[model samples]
Target: MTSTPTRSSDTTSSEYDSDDTNQSVHSDDTSSEDIEEVDEVVDNVAQGDPIWECQMCGALMWYQERKDNSRHSTVPKFQLCCGGGKVKLPLLEQPPQLLQDLLFGNQSPATKNFQTNIRTYNAMFSFTSPGMKMDTKINNGKGPPTLRMQGQTCHRVGSLLPLPGDSPKYAQLYIFDTDNEISNRMNSVRTNKDIDEEIVKKLKLMLDQNNVHAKVFRMAMDMLNDVNFQDVKVKLIADRKTDGRIYNKPTVSEVAALVLGDIDSASHRDIIMQGQSGNLQRIDEFHASYLSFQYPLIFPYGEDGYRPSILLRFVDDTDITKKKKLTIMHWLSFRLQRRKGEALTLLCSRKLLQQFSCDGYTMMEAERLNWLRRNQSKLRVGKYRQIAETPTTNNQSGPTLKGKRVVLPSTFVGSKRYMDQLYFDGMAISNDRPDIVARVFKIKFDELMKDLTKRHILGKVLAYMYTIEFQKRGLPHAHILVFLHPTSKYPTPADIDKIISAEIPDPKIHNELYNLVRSHMIHGVIP
Candidate 1:
């Protein structure tokens, strides 16, 4: 979250001291006047107009009214918000050197490009708003307003780049570390069972030597050993306040400056402050410009923006009251209408439609399963019971029931009724198969086998078999075996070379095939 610096009202010490001295000199003529002067000085020191602001929180205070007014110190500390540095936060370790060079190094094209379009870059990466709101209804419209911290206060990152032979960075580094991971897994089950300290010690020693998350492991160990660790609080959001009309809350730019290690740099401040114009860009503009810097994957193309080649299919040009414009929603609506049932209508509740559109079938399936589970005894007593009890004539023994049965009738999943209900099930009608990608792969495999056998692409397939399987990420793939006729078999190396090639297709001659191979056949490192 970026913080903006607030302009404080300047009060010169010379003017204040001179005015007070003159007042005191005249007041020395009378005891009452001297007492009044003393009271005035005390009041000025206690609750007079704020002149200095806290660095962490935006809490304002008079120079003399600071938490620590040491004579040796030029500036005083404010303690109300963050307990005068008692609440310390872990430092955000600097990014990799290569990344830093690309982003902030001198005479670099990446840096130049980034700086030239900093707004666009920031917009591409940032996730949440730094701006906070105050609850005016608190304290019955009295005292300081209660701070209402909303939105994401910190970056919620996904997986980090898997660099070869290096400790995992970011969230993975924290989670997979020996101490953190063991503590997390053990704590969940610790209530039910006691943890063996000896076993834990042995595991930690083993992990310390070979752990992939060693960096965070060392950091965690150090933090555990530190006596002052209890005082440290991770700096996530800026929660500061001021009383009355003295608005001292820091701006987004100031917060950003602090985070970027530019707290004292005038040139960086000038750039962030937009060249001393004192006029800050709107929140929307700030978000658009800086978000990209934080989450690059979300906006991979940077300033190029998302421009899909889709047109609006259902437009009402006749309605002159508003301009007709194409949008992503229009494209979605158009794609949805191609289904063979009733026309897509905008007259229904969009929220309900959205609910059913994405995971309605899954939800319905869950409900059906739950119903079957609840009525298992009732289902087992009827025709399902007969089907389960019916034994094979040559069977060594009748089928044995291992657990409670929850039979799904043919009518529920495979009959004409089941097919008919699909039209009204609110599922997205697309190329994808029902429920899972494995089904789609099965269909494609069937089509390929049909073509191979009928068209003889692989020469009179004598026998063929395939097993569909899913990857760790749930993507479906297949392993196939085909036996060709003896007459069509490639017996020589030359014959095999003629029929099969490993080289990529020439894009100029086989544009479509080249694209297909590039998009689907090719695989690369995950990162």
Candidate 2:
């Protein structure tokens, strides 16, 4: 590794390790070239410069410059928390960009996008026109009425608002754009705190009850899968559907008996068989796979016109465990059924019904767990170093914080398709409904993939994985990963740039495009 300077104040900076979890001391293994590099670093520090070392791990080192020691000087003396002064240290290497963003805030030195590379455009226009008049017609109730205004002219009421035809002087003006309007709206914090507290109180009670329900549901399903209770599934389905005096609804105790007892419970089977049109109609065919009972936790159950939850089933037994198949089933279910269309209603086993009898998860905890699992292995900083050896960004990390250079890490990884979906959601708003964003994301993503396929940007899309995430400001963003045909991989910067842009577009020729570029694409200076 070549020597690269680091900030003297960054105490967190340390030697790069292959694995973050492994904290054992490094072995005294050194190549001749590494020893020479260490010697050179020692020679530079021995001249008079000081160095910083980790308080917890004394192995890592960072070089620091000597500051004035006179009482009158403003410069502070360098010291380590472990009660040690700067000392000559062996060579150390820099960390990855991902780590740098984590240790410090995200800093972009090489890329122009990090800085304000484009100027924000401001324009002002008014409908007012000079030397213009509006003619007033008699109010006979025959045609539309016309009125005159001092500063502007009016044509027919239904015609598009036209600008003045004559040449006029112009002046630059600044006004809030659509994006600024949304930002302003987001900035307005709701004054009432009690509403949130009450909501939390209700939510907590709901989650606790749901957890109890989920445990019961899981237990019931397990019991139904038992060999002795082969016909129990049919009884449960019949019990749910039957609603007359001759046939009785299964009580919770009877349901418990069916789950806890053995011997097939002939009475339960009779009740189910007689309730149905046929006596013994393919009982095994009615049994659902254990995986078919999956139910997603939903909140504000009252507003959802259908039952609070559903006993989700797949198209076939083979698709039961496949998450994608389940997702597609749900998508179609809603698109066909919930959208005021016809949907085939299958008999849900009583065991599956019991699982959703109560709500079962805290939205906050569920969201947290889901996010943790989703991004557990996403790209992150391993090591990072500053681009220049000028003044340290932090006062604690002083000058002479030099170290060996390391490779820059990837900017993003995981799923590109999901990220694109998220970008599109942020750009568009529809019907003032929050839940719609999820559907919109899926729709837009499909269209985007289809368009990309037509252009052969990445060749035929083989498969894709995606997730929807909500922003703090209440907008949904999508994260997706696409698998493409081997021949369609983006191999070079030029090939990638054909589909993506890093720089601002020229405003003179591409006025409309420039507005979009400035509003969304630009990444401002890192704080």
Candidate 3:
């Protein structure tokens, strides 16, 4: 059997090659060292073959293997990565004209520099690829090839140039086209029973009325719909300064006024009165604190604010004659100083800090266990008598009730609610098991046992045992031990070599298996 070549063969000859070869031959009269240097230069030039990039997949190919060989071909087409002109994809919409002109069209030094160093800019903004090394001589050339994953793998996008008559793709597709957006939303909601036709209609109306991007889309559409490009350009130039002057920028006070909304109003006065009388609710205090409402931006589901009692206590303690109220600045200063000292003191003792963390963890675990015990009746396995009495098709010959006590699941490590419960529904993984991972593992182990014992994957199996273990990273792995029949056991080196080989499989022959092994089985040195 012959193996297929990994890359295309370069068969095209050029005038450049002929000219270089002739020059090298004529220069042979020079010194031997000079002739050798000339030969090396010729070899280097020959190795520098012309490469063509695919217009569809951005994959590099030999110029000789290009689908289009026309003299005027600006964009080369290829057949290997994407089927020859078969794959039709929507194009990414061009950036706004102003942005395009600023970035690419302008002849300014900044623009020229940006265009020249675009790759550098991209590398600066994007993630860096890691460097890795592998020992190729580990187990000789016949052993498994040492491999190291040096970087993250990502999809290579094709050229951004829009195809003729192709619709906008990606974010632009959803942003600008209302009908397309609505249709997409409808398709997404088709399977959801809660969102009916009426709800969808209401949603469409809401999007039409309140969608913030609608104005931007309308402006873009207006630009596209202009009958005379010159007139639109003139109008834009004329209104540029006027538009800038007309746009009112809100001040800090104005923004505060908008958020607070008429402090002298009856509702505001009532809240103020409640606060003054020490009768304000926690919700009122929360709304009063600007920091607490905006805390979600920094920490999701987080709140930051002082309780009414704390504020009152601060005011009472600070006032010498109980006459003056503590100002916001004073309260903030006090809190900041208090927190700084506390943090510093905590940092001073490592053991004490560790003890605190351990105590907190212990408290949390205790609370979780208490909650589970209190809610045991809510779990499916709580009704152990009913489950024991229930007849099972597989257990017809065995006693229905083996024990009275409900056994807890071994898989529960208090990670999530689904994993913590003894039994979620009528179906129990064990007598009272939980967690999808545990269930999946059990099913897979059963399948393996069936293959070994019943299917006779390795002749007749005398005995077999397996243990599932979790690595330090919490990922589960299995170790299996099989005792095969005497006839099936590998007695010779040849038989052992046939059964077990430590090497990467040929990708061309076993593509799926090769990919699986490369992705999951390959291990590299930890940084």
Candidate 4:
């Protein structure tokens, strides 16, 4: 979200501030699944013990026992993967300095044959050192390794095969091993295509500002086509320089022309899709609170990673505003807290919650919650961050309880330092009286900010965004998303619809609805 411009009688508004030079990235997808719980348990052996413990997954072994044990076991004696050989030469080789030149094949061998046949009988017997052989180890010698040799005691871990570094085979290996996950992600924008023109025009119109910024572009394609994806294509579609009448703007590709220099060499298969669309459909009865009205939408917001343009499958009446509040207490960890950017705030209706078994959605893949240990194993758990928020039963306000309110500092909200998913509303002072234009732009905007202290929702309002769609003929109605306190309560759908219809910025935030004008855009097959 960016700055809003003052309204005028001008037919079309000016372009938004599109200089997204700061490059604010939409959230990146993350997973803590493979993060093993490591505990360093020094063996009870004496201080001088020769065993070197595996620091990886916390498994221990005595040098002799490890050398003699069988190789096949579910619980490996060593934590890290080992190269198969009778002896791992790199792991040993005393007089560390001498080992460097020998391993590098830089030093002259003791004998001619030793130089050419490093692992042959000729090299072993033709030593040029004073009195040494490759097959012999001296226990008490002050001489170099060339003078005192040891038997070949190589390791026998796996096959002594080198891993893939740059070959296509390596890429395929990693892809198949990870279920082709790397190829599916749209992390860097270099691969994603440009945004459509209609979408760019619409976003500028929706927010009512000039010079909007298109920061990041998100694109994704699932390995499984049937799986649900959200907001697949995203870009910072902000306003470019204004040209008065038309508010001429540069396309995402135009301002980002510098990056295009490398596009020809990039493979289309490698890059994922990004940016937004003008029309998108809603998911069926899945979310009761999400789509009370059918209206056009470009992106579908969800809890997981973004995918390209697609129709919604189910009605996800999830209340992000309320969910964000609980996320802090449930998901983040101290390490994560330090890294996650800000405290996220969202508005949600508490009463919409069906079952508060105190459990939250499970994460089979990318997760945005605080990391925790549930059963000694590193399994994920969405704890009891649930708080049912209901507006005053009596509409009475004197520190009286009509609804539940939990106030947490921005630091602890959502565990990380990220603030997003705000919730706010602006209804006209009177539903019966109509002050169409001025009230919609100015008055509503003022009331929107003023509603902050009212505890309409539970989080702080850092950034805000809303939409104004042309409902029937020429006039516009709004579908906005705000960024505020995580604990904010959800505004009911009925209240939201009534407020939005008046077009005075009176629509209440709905945890479960979309503008009716957006219904056609809700159902498209995801690529």
Best candidate, lDDT: 1
Off by over 4 Å in 1: 1-174, 177-357, 377-381, 390-404, 409-527
TM per prediction: 0.17, 0.17, 0.17, 0.13
Q: Compute the lDDT of residue 146 as modeled in candidate 2.
A: 30
Tell me the TM-score of model 3.
0.17
Runs in model 2 deviating more than 4 A are 1-432, 453-457, 504-525
lDDT of 1 at 84: 47
Angstrom error of the Cα, residue 316, model 2: value is 58
Query: What's model 3's lDDT at 347?
Result: 25
What lDDT does model 2 reach? 0.31
Candidate 2 structure quality by residue, lDDT tens digits, 452-497:
6555556777777778777655666668787788887788999889
> Whose lDDT is higher: candidate 2's or candidate 4's?
2
Candidate 3 ranges with C-alpha deviation above 4 Å: 1-164, 171-211, 226-527
**lDDT of candidate 1 over 1-527, digit per residue (tens):** 11111123473121233322211112223344433443345444433445345443344444454575443122446544334432222112233333344344559555454334332322222322233332335538656423343432222332221234534323233333434544543443313143433333343343334322233224433553467542221112222222211222223332232122233333211222211122222222112222222332222222111112212122232223232333223222222321223122211213223322332233234445666768867755465556556455665576665555456644477545467677435234322344555566678878887888877987988988888776544566778888899998988988989777698888999989988888767786321
- Across 157-234, the per-residue lDDT of candidate 3 in tens digits comes to 111111445443321232334466444443432233333343334433432343222222334345434554212210
